[model samples]
Target: MTDQLPDAIVAGPKGPALDLLHIVQINEEIKSVVAVAFKINIMALNAIFLAKRAGTAALGFGVLSNELRSFSSQLRETMLSLNALIHASVDGVSAMLQDSRYNDILERAVVLASKNKHLQEVIEQRENATDQFRSKLSGLRRALRSSVDDAYRLVELGGVLAKSAKIEAAYGAGFSSSLSQVSGEFDGIVEEIRTSLDTLRKSSFFRG
Candidate 1:
């Protein structure tokens, strides 16, 4: 009887629903940030072409150099930040499970879910910021590519290198900040789930 599925776990099955929703939200955010970052990169390269066309190619580096790098870094940071949160959440949960503390693990999971909701709200802020410049990012990218004779691949390659820190930083920030909100507040729920997982994982009635 101890090994059997709990009524809530078996009957409700909201795990899959929550999983799919989280995945979709993460995907949408990643795509949005990547698209924006990529555009900034292309625009940066195109400044060179614009310089050549205007016969100021010689001074192009002086004029747009600062803007291009700054803008590119900003967009890439956004993408990296989003990616970080996703990784942190996954890793935090995994670590909790590995510690063999069911109560602690359940408590952490609930807190993470709450943090995840907050992350989505932050994403909404980002979406709103880009509404006015919906196509501008992509348009600048195209113009830059045509102007500089650079392939899209090169820009993407540069982006990969520049945006590395964003994911972890963003994820950890959001998760950790709200973590205290749910900490130690769900003892009953945590105990219940902890017991359920322990029983399912082993024959022993009591865990050390």
Candidate 2:
């Protein structure tokens, strides 16, 4: 039979690190989506200006242009919020992982020293220290899982916003191509986010 203790100890911190790496990639992609949104917003504004110059003939186009602009702004804001969530999550995991590794190394050192004469007391002390650190790792795992849930929610919001952007693009004229491009980019990013979330959720990290 395999030792469950080591398995738990190893999975506690390493799993979050793995998930955090995926989140980092998703975070960078979301930034690209933000840039696309900004470009779409500019295109929408240009369309609005053109519609205005066309006067009464293009009044409907002007209304659509305003709607597209609003959609782009909302999309960009959502992307920003997603990016912030990822950054905060990454920071938390990075710190916890660093500390966990440090403690792991110390525990290993104490174990090796136990091979020498009259080191039983040191071994007992190290065991207590390891136990405390294990509790900390458990807490970190919980925090990481909570972060993953937040990420899932954010990605879902992004996907919804992307769908709305595509719908808005259908009504735009001069800016339709630009808006469609932005929506497509958002779709791609959202797909990646979904994949990451799936991987994290299916992993054994948070399982009983």
lDDT (tens digit, per residue) of candidate 1 on 1-208: 4899889667752332333334344445455546655654564455334334434323423244334456556545644554554454334333333432443454566577766766567545645644433334334323322322222333333334333222211233334232222222222222332333233223111111
Q: Which candidate leads in TM-score?
A: 2
Model 2, range 12-108, lDDT digits (tens) per residue? 6344466566556656556665776687678668767866765665565566567657766776666666566656656665665665566577667
Candidate 2 residue-pair clash tally: 0
lDDT of each: 0.39, 0.62
What C-alpha lDDT does candidate 1 achieve relative to the native structure?
Answer: 0.39
Question: Largest lDDT belongs to which candidate?
Answer: 2
RMSD over all Cα atoms, model 2: 7.7
Those runs of model 1 whose alpha carbons end farther than 4 Å from true positions after fitting are 1-20, 56-66, 93-208
